[model samples]
Target: MFKNNNTCLAVFTGIIGVVFFSAKAVMVKLAYQYDVSPVNLLMFRMLFALPFYIVILFITRKKSEEHGLGVKDFIWLLFFGFIGYYLASYFDFLGLQYIKASIERVILFIYPTIVVILSAVFLKRKVGPVQILAIAITYVGVLVAFWDEFRIEGSEFLTGAGLIFLSALTYASYLTGSDFLIPKFGVLRFTSYAMIIACISVVTHCSLSEEASLSGYHANVYWLGLAMAFLSTVIPSFMVSYSIKEIGASNFSVLGSLGPVSTIILASIFLDEKFTILQMGGTIIVIFGVVVISLQKRRKHT
Candidate 1:
């Protein structure tokens, strides 16, 4: 929909979308400080989003009768939602509880590399030297930003790290698998349905395992948690889905490598975190790596 007649609009939209999404980390930190447990926090996040997702799905279905979702869509969407949103978000929140936000961010930044790797394997996409280099740079930047935060050895950190990476992998899988669905179903329709599914899944899990929904949270924390649902989940999910439709997943994913860079900047601003010279240098190197990978990919295509 951008008038640039180029995918640059998708790029810009994606960056903004992710930046908005990045704000959730601060929200999460705040929510946690206010004494919200992970399960209840995630439940609040999901249940609050449920009705909106349903209403959107209902509207989208009415408009596109011929292309309306069906059993198969539901099946795939269930898998997509449960794995992508439910499992991934749960793992992310849980990991964040155990790890520093900076370390958690670095772990999450690995998803772009996961996306590129999965694209190569599942989509048979060509990878070039530059693209590989870009992925390397991105990870290096993440390490730079988080190196001070991580002490480099232990079961707890390692397990948290693994879960964080698993969260990333699950999300990458969702992006790769659902790229086709974006074109087939439109972003709004696909995401509304999938998010509803994810919400329901999380709610069911919370009900079974947790004491209650939205318990022990201040009004501020509750509202911030809701903002997390809207900004982090709703907005970025829709924007990325649309971008995938416009530019294909690989390009979209390459752009996603910017997420950690943006996260570092946002954390410094909103969370009152200090931005050290090392973190800055790492981010710059990561940017260079991402450029290299992208150029390599382009050369391969050419």
Candidate 2:
């Protein structure tokens, strides 16, 4: 009974996390209304998000020490932080400039399939027929939705889609590469460390880039940045981490299928982005493919 109760709680937590995470793009879209550059906006997010991660890191210091981390590991953490959070997030923010929030969410959701491909390439994981078929299904769905967006949004859609795809690719690389690091440092500690690295990276980049000034934004832009930082980044980060700890990563990942669906709804309600039949079909197909991969992972673990 207790186990079942914990699972139920984890499910609730995971769902909320997914919703808040999905809300990020909407918040970004809203912020863009003020003509803020992606780097400038992202700088605000990482800045607001920085303190919470610092607290987490301090709290987890003892646990982090238990793992005998070295200079080599820190270097890798820097790399992971740069590629995973910094680059991926910057690309995602830039992509949002040109694409609808709904389309960006769907494209980002394809990270699981990218993870499978990355694993097969780098980890020498065997790709069974089931995995291949799922990959095919996933990309076909992406293409269908992407083609529809292209028809309407024209040439700029390709640029946005390409940027979002790169965001997914880099994030997938992080997940694939960080498999060992998570176990060693623990999820929260490792995440905080990586996030700190990413925050520093963003700040430094902003300082160097003349176009990425942090001044002269409307108050709403700052408010939305705070919303993205807390609602989307810090709070959900901890919630999703707890959910994963309780219910396991595979289960947590399966629950992530709700992310794009929630994003679609949120985009429509908040951003006035239209919800079309093709988009719905594509989302369903993509979720189906991701579910297949997640289920396969569960089976392998069990």
C-alpha RMSD of each candidate structure in angstroms: 3.0, 3.5
Taking all chains together, the TM-score of candidate 2 against the true structure is: 0.83
- Estimate every model's Cα lDDT from 0 to 1: 0.75, 0.79
TM-score of model 1 vs. true structure = 0.88
Model 2 spans > 4 angstroms off:
1-16, 126-147, 239-257, 281-302
Write candidate 2's Cα lDDT for 1-302 as tens digits.
56656666766787788889889999999999999999999999999999999998998788667457788887888898899889999999999998889789777877866666676787676667866776677666666654666467667888999999999889777766665566667879878888899899999999999898767889999999998999998888767666666544434545565677788789889989887887778778867776675555445545
lDDT of 1 by residue, 127-210 (tens): 766566566667777777667666555568887888888888898888887776766677898888788888988888887984
Model 1 deviation from native, Cα RMSD in Å: 3.0
Q: Model 1, poorest ten-residue lDDT window? A: 293-302
Supply the global lDDT for candidate 2: 0.79
Clashing pairs in 2: none
